[model samples]
Target: MDEEVIARYLARRDAIDQSVDLVVLMGSAVLESVEVAAEAHRTYAAPILISGGIGHSTHYLEGAVRRRDCRSRWIGRSRTSFAIC
Candidate 1:
């Protein structure tokens, strides 16, 4: 993703300052996109809820492994909920 797009997302996230219980990041960019989202969630002091299912476009096991790795990395200090959907 471009830095400009990421900056925009971060700006939007900074505009809100409420407790968030869940965050669902979907689509092809799930691996990296959710990391950025998780950073934003930390800034808001919110737990994260990730939801996405491996589709024909990607290897199911690989996607699941990557998502799990992301969860493990970010699951510290904040509660995390995950569902493959």
Candidate 2:
């Protein structure tokens, strides 16, 4: 890729970061995502949503967050509790 093109892409990414309403963490960055969500919650009081099952690391991440008493409701997969009313 050209240097100018890469720079443009990075600039666009920064723009998106500035305008995003919610941040989701997944894949290999789950741990980092947890910390970001928690801190963002403290600073902005914005809701954070986390979902997984893409790989084996999801379970470990979920456990870590639970151990820390992270306040979040689990949705999707086997954690959901919704009725089609």
Candidate 3:
């Protein structure tokens, strides 16, 4: 990627929307998503809606939480509720 293109992408990506209503965390193998969701919630004071079910990334998600010592609650098998403080 060209430096100018990368800079433009970063500028757009880092732009914050002032009218955000919720922080959504889609279940994935990447633990960084969780961190981002939590941070968003903290910054926006928006409700978080965690979406996903048991899949290839289930174990990875669980492991990531453990590794981070993240406090979380499971709302059945598909949905999870995270309290961002």
Best by TM-score: 3
The TM-score that candidate 3 achieves is 0.57
lDDT of all predictions: 0.54, 0.50, 0.68
What RMSD does model 2 have? Answer: 9.3
* RMSD (Å) of each candidate, 1 decimal: 8.3, 9.3, 5.6
Q: In candidate 1, what are the lDDT values of residues 14-82, reduced to their tens digit?
A: 455566666655544335565676776777666665554445545553456465664455334222233
Q: Which ten residues in a row have the lowest lDDT in candidate 3?
A: 76-85
User: 1-85, model 2: which lDDT tens digit per residue?
Assistant: 6999985774352223344466654434235545555676666556766555446664665575566555344445343221111
Runs in model 2 deviating more than 4 A are 1-20, 27-30, 54-85
Cα lDDT for residue 7, model 2?
A: 57
Global lDDT of model 3: 0.68
Model 1 residue 7 lDDT score: 68
Per-residue CA lDDT of model 3 for 3-22, tens digit only, reads 99985773354659686798
